[model samples]
Target: MKHGALLRKISVVGVSAACCIALVGCGGTNYGYTGGVAATVNGAEIQEDTITKYIQDFRTSSDLTSDDDWGNWMKENSFDPATVRDQVIDYYVENELKKQACDEKGITVEQSQVDDEINNMKANYDSDDAWKQALSSAGLTEDQYRESVEAGLLDEALEDAVAGDAATADDSKVLDMLNTYYTMFNGAKKSSHILFASGDTEKAQEVLDQINAGTLDFAEAAKQYSTDTASAADGGNVGWDAINSFVTDYTDALDGLSVGQVSGLVTSDYGIHIIKCTDEFTCDGKATSLSAYPQEFVDYISNIVKDQSKSTAYSNWFNDYKAQADIQNNDMPENVPYNLDMTKYDNSDSSSDNSDGSSNGASADTNADASATEDSSESSNEKSSDSENSGQ
Candidate 1:
């Protein structure tokens, strides 16, 4: 994770409630407010000061210091100033809602947990000054940041309590998950291809004819004639992968072939190809009994399933609670410092310039972006052990 993105992640900690609001339109009346309150959730007033501080924190952490920087950042993220204000307010409202729900369930964060979390966060930076600078940039004092961490811990406790047994992968659940993985990996096919340049079908066919007549070995033909140098060196062997991973024409040719069968001329966006199914595996039924799979792989997949189950459980609980909560997002005040004037910031030069010059930066949307970030992180982590053999 980037250092800058950490604050954004922190800012949107209890966003599941915000997602509920976005999916099923905001409930309760929008009783416009005055005198510095931004919103109210179940009679708990969310102060405008709090919202301003958070917005400023977000701006500072994101390095949107200059007016141009702010404009460019907003434009790049497809956000209008008003929408940014609303999103900040929505974050607080949702957080308050989570706090209230947690409070109702008697969930609490211990001081030790808060301290440990702060220590962990501080460890991410090089020195105490750097950590303090990060906090200052996010417009948070040590006490204020501690409070935020406590709130986060409470949210976690609430989720764990609600998820209960569903969050745990026992022996039975692990077995079921193993079967699911077996079905996918067991059915995958491995193929080798001798690729030729676009409009070189005649060359591809000539190579195929040589391989068919046994005048030239497939591996030799691939090494000699294949345009895809990466796989060509490995006897044109693209390791086992899902069918959908290949281009349409390549998939079609590979799918039609039985194990050890060579395909006819296959043309795709990459080029023309003569493909051979090098290896294939299929499970008999659902793999009801366990077969020897690496314990590490089994554990990795089990953890993933458990995490997914916890997320689903939390989503369900939050959605239910949000439906019942008497929430109200009062109108933002005109005088708040963070209520930027969209007209003053010209975003025409921004890469993501919007023709209409306005966008909905709902807090819920951040959750989706965060998920993408997490998925990208996971992909990077897996990159060392996994690779795709594109026939290009």
Candidate 2:
């Protein structure tokens, strides 16, 4: 899908930009009940109330006001409410796993950290009252919001531990990153074009003929006939970009073109286009060899590579943990999907079977182990400048 289409998919969560800075969620209706169990992780029950809060929070964030609204929204978005409910459950379950992992690793989130995080989040508002009002709109009390923040922090701590041991990048990984982001490996190209929708083939051909015959300037043709209005407005200048940014067909069409040379109609996923090669140059705007690039540039690329390595390290560690987690759906409502197993160890390790008899083996379960601890008053005071789930 086009980038514009993807924006619409997530536009309902208008708070995303703020959340990126504040780590606060949109909040939800007060989930009043407290006793029923939704699921158990490593023998510890995840309360139905907690699951309800997450579901409600998700709904509020998605701009769904009620269960009915959630159902209708699902239909319009081509999703099943049951599937969404399951996803919410999974999100909560992951939180539980993070808590468990932290415990095993003897990681305790400092209360001070949480307090700092909260203060920073509050700073995003005009005043404390404004922040509280925002929380209230999301159906959260000050206390409840704090709990989510702490949970988020704990998740982060676990992730940090995992990333600390991240593997160093291999040659293949470095090459992949260079191909996508840096133009030093190969010269970069800049160009502009008029994109015609797939169905407007005839119109595209007409415009192509005009440009070839000098009857119309490329920029004017693009501004007048291009369906991609955003690029058209800039006189079809897509700006300087990595050579690999374009699809194979588009790049293939540009082959053999000299500077200021316009190509014939080129087809891509977006539409048919006339490409004008404006410039090609080294990424650093210099003729330096890869070995002679400045130390700062090398360090910059190294840091980017390290960041990618850290993510991979954490994912590998987490997936292994999930493969052995012992999870049981205890009190999910009937008609909800009951297969709660998250591990890959099922059947292979008969010894890990749940005594509760819900299902046998890792295939029927997931695993993480920590003595579940209620967030204490001290831990609740800690916070971070990172995301709601940044710690994870």
Using TM-score as the measure, the top candidate is 1
Candidate 1 ranges with C-alpha deviation above 4 Å: 1-35, 60-76, 120-140, 168-290, 338-369, 372-392
- Per-residue lDDT of 312 in model 2: 63
lDDT of 2 by residue, 225-278 (tens): 877676777677664433124566777766557679998878776677788887
Off by over 4 Å in 2: 1-35, 60-63, 66-68, 123-126, 133-139, 167-179, 183-294, 334-392
Model 1 TM-score, 2 decimals: 0.52
TM, every model: 0.52, 0.48
